[model samples]
Target: MKTADCDILILPGLAGSEEDHWQARWASRLPTARIVVQDDWHAPEPEAWRRRIAEAVAAARRPVILIAHSLGVVAAVEAAPDFPPDVVRGALLVALPDVEEAPDLPDSVRAFAPLPRDPLPFPSLLVASRTDPHCAYARAEDFAYAWGAQIVDAGDSGHINVASGHGPWPEGLMRLAGFLKTL
Candidate 1:
């Protein structure tokens, strides 16, 4: 489906997407897009994050398309089963952090461990970086298989965030546009 026909919800990771973050930039560029505002960005609670995403989807005027990154990806997966199938048409999941194997993960993030393996109810694409510090390449592949998502290898793009020098991330925008076309 075309972007104008859907509500694009941007779900940012831990601490939220900053002004320079690609997710934020994408939200600005896409007139139909809006960020799913979480109550707490610094120390996320899984249930709360899930609730926020659900609320955003519920509030949308049209079918929703999720643009999620890092922890946001986890929250989306956890919340998907609860959402009405027709509410969410597709999702662009990026930089999924492997909290289960992340030794240095904060207590807040650790709560989302043992990542949801249930296949999503809608079409989705998972974009992963080979050198992402938060998740190993093999683990990301495992997630893609388990979640029933198409995987795109983003070579050496650390977490695919601002710190990784992906503020504009035109490549990601292109990929997102392509994914939207499939829906």
Candidate 2:
């Protein structure tokens, strides 16, 4: 199924994607896209995040396509088991933050130490940056392997957020569209 044929659910990272963030820009550009709201974008409760994502997937009318960034990527994995595989066609997982090693990491994130590594039941892509301060390239690849997702290199993009200057993120949107076409 084409990406345009599915319900695009964008999940932002810790602190949430700002108004001008790539995720926000994509939502405006895509006629049928919406953001999956976490209970608290700041506090970051794993179970709450998981439940919110699961609920969003459960309510989806069409095949669901997930676009997640930063800690939201982890939450997506946590919610994966509850998402009936038939409804969730694929995901664009990106910018995993190292909650384990972030010295100044919030208490909420550290609480999620020892992330899950089980392979995902659906087709997905894991996009990572070489210079992301939060996570190493090697670790991102490891996640891709464990989650059974195809890895995509995003060069030196910093967490792929607005802070890194990915305002419009036209390229990322095009790439997402390409992935959606394959679904």
Candidate 3:
């Protein structure tokens, strides 16, 4: 499906994406895209994050296409089963953080631990970075496999965020466009 035909929901990671983050840039460019505002970003509660995603999807006027990064990816996956069937057409999941195993993350992330292994209900693509501090590349592959999502190796791309120097992320936009075409 074309972008214009879907509601693109941009779900940012912990503390939310900065103004220069790719998600934020894309939200400005993509006519139908909007960020799903979380009630709290500093210390995430898994159930609240999951419920928020479900609520966003439930309210979409058109078929939903999720653009999620880091913790948002986990929340989206956690909320998958709650979504009304077929309401979500697809998802572009990037930089999935290892909430279960990452030692450096805050303790609160543990609430989202033991990541769900069920296949997502919609078509999806997971873009993973080999050097992301939050998750191991192999683990990202595992997530993609479990979710039945096509995996793209973004070699050495640290979390694919602004700090990693992906402010505009034109390449990501191209990849998203390609994914949309397949739907």
Q: Give each model's clash number.
A: 1, 1, 1
Deviating ranges (above 4 Å) for candidate 1:
none
State the lDDT of candidate 2 residue by residue for 70-183, as single tens digits.
Answer: 888888887899997698899999888877775667888877777778999899999899989888888999889999999999998987887787888888878887887787
lDDT of 3 by residue, 46-158 (tens): 99999999999999999999999999999999999999989999999999999988878888877798899999999999999999999999999998999999999999899
Model 3 scores a C-alpha lDDT of 0.94
What is the total number of backbone clashes in candidate 1?
1
lDDT of 1 by residue, 1-183 (tens): 888999999999999999999999889999999999998899899999998898888888899999999999999999997787689999999999998997667989989987989888899999999989889989999999998999999998998998899998999989988998888
Question: Judged by lDDT relative to the true structure, which candidate is superior, 2 or 3?
Answer: 3
**Worst 10 contiguous positions by lDDT, candidate 3:** 102-111
lDDT of 1 at 91: 94
Give the Cα lDDT of each candidate.
0.92, 0.86, 0.94
TM-scores of all candidate predictions against the true structure: 0.98, 0.95, 0.98
Superposed Cα deviation of residue 35, candidate 1 (Å): 0.5
* Model 2 Cα shift for residue 157 (angstroms): 1.1
